[model samples]
Target: MMRSGPTPDAGDLPFELPRTTPRERARASALARALASAYPDAHCELAYSSPHELLVATILSAQATDVGVNKATPALFARFPTPAAYARATPGEIEPYIKSIGLYRNKAKAIHAAMKDIVERFDGRVPGTMHDLLTLRGVARKTANVVLGNAFGVHVGFVVDTHVQRLATRFGLVAPGASITMIERRLMALFPREEWCILSHRLIWHGRRACKARGAGCADHPVCREFGSACELRISAPSRATGGAPARAKPAALKRSAPRRS
Candidate 1:
């Protein structure tokens, strides 16, 4: 049986505690390998050529799909190709390009303001460090992590978006209702620092293509087949023909326990 103890609430723990046991680390490593093989070309779906473009795209991606962002960015980038151009343009001018995306007004305002900051403070270059990147409008930890990882190849932290959160929970890497920060901490502990960035992409790919939120396609996926039974949310295999839940089977006796707080 898995070990147990009187663990404190997740809120009580430090935001970043790299403290996974040997078995958990091994499991995480294996999961990463399987995902890498399954999705060989998994990468940041946002299309961008420069760091500035990526920063803008990441900001726009908030509460929006990457496909949506990509659809909007071609014209948006054409109009405001450089940080100085974005800084100079008014939000009203920017809004027309990204209007199809959700919260375009607010995102345009943030993009305008962030570019102005880049122009004035960083001399038109997108800041590479998390500290400097966080100062920009609408640039949260998730956005910063995206830019740092993909644009600059810096693995300061992992990106924990909705997909990452759901997949991590489904993989039994974290408990249900765990905060994004706690989930990120658990992932950081489980995987090596270098794999942090790409790991998020792989999880996202799996989440989007297979382990969907409403009806997960978990029947034949290697990682899901191996790990699905222990999922905190109890992901069920879906029927191939109907895309509905398969008929229930007798529950297997629990073997590996759900992850416990250390």
Candidate 2:
């Protein structure tokens, strides 16, 4: 994958053991401003109807695309409709639907165990609080954030996936070698709590669509002005710009009726 340069006003990682300068903070702020403006319509792409669905979908999303997870979830949900059903399902049965996703065997075990825990401990309900959600097997901060934001509508923090991590680093949002928790902490300081969830979703969308992992489409990218990387803007020819139609009339052809040049 091709790595983009640091965002405008950004420098080396901040918040190292010794601490960092104001430049990192300014960079984070600038990039956040650009991203917030550029992606006003950002949202979670994973398809789900309920908290339990979100939980299972997020777990299945490990190293897998949201589209892939959506494909497998309908069948998985149909087979194991509830926590009790999932708890009772054998790993062998669950594996087949999600087998195409990354870490299928392990995810099968975790989801099975997690559903069982929800039933036995939480009374067959997905817990809303961070404290209760973390108790499930294979549930990490990333998964917990998904449940909190999508299922409960609680925006506790930003969920740092690979896209978020890479973008944050490029934007100088966090110091190098900083843990996810550290990144979340720094981001919390930069962005309002309300924007956290949407910000992540939008950035991920932008990263996937325009600023792709390999080659980026920097042409007229809204955030380009705020990026530290140097990129050229590519403008299509005027003929191509007119909706693939020819110009109204060629200047040379129009001037043909006029007097010839000396």
Q: Which candidate should be chosen as best, given lDDT against the real structure? A: 1
**Cα error, candidate 2, residue 163 (Å):** 0.5
Question: Model 1: which residue pairs collide?
Answer: none
Tens digits of per-residue lDDT for model 2 on 1-262? Answer: 2222222222322422223234444555677778777877788888888899899999988888898888889898998889899888887788998987888999999899999999999999999988789988878878999899878988666788877765554444543345677667556556556667888887787667665544344435767535522132222222322122112212110001221110
State the local distance difference test value for candidate 2. 0.67
> Cα deviation of 258 in candidate 1 (Å)?
24
Superposed model 1: Cα runs more than 4 Å off: 1-16, 229-262
Q: How does each model score on lDDT? A: 0.76, 0.67
TM agreement with the true structure for every prediction: 0.82, 0.75
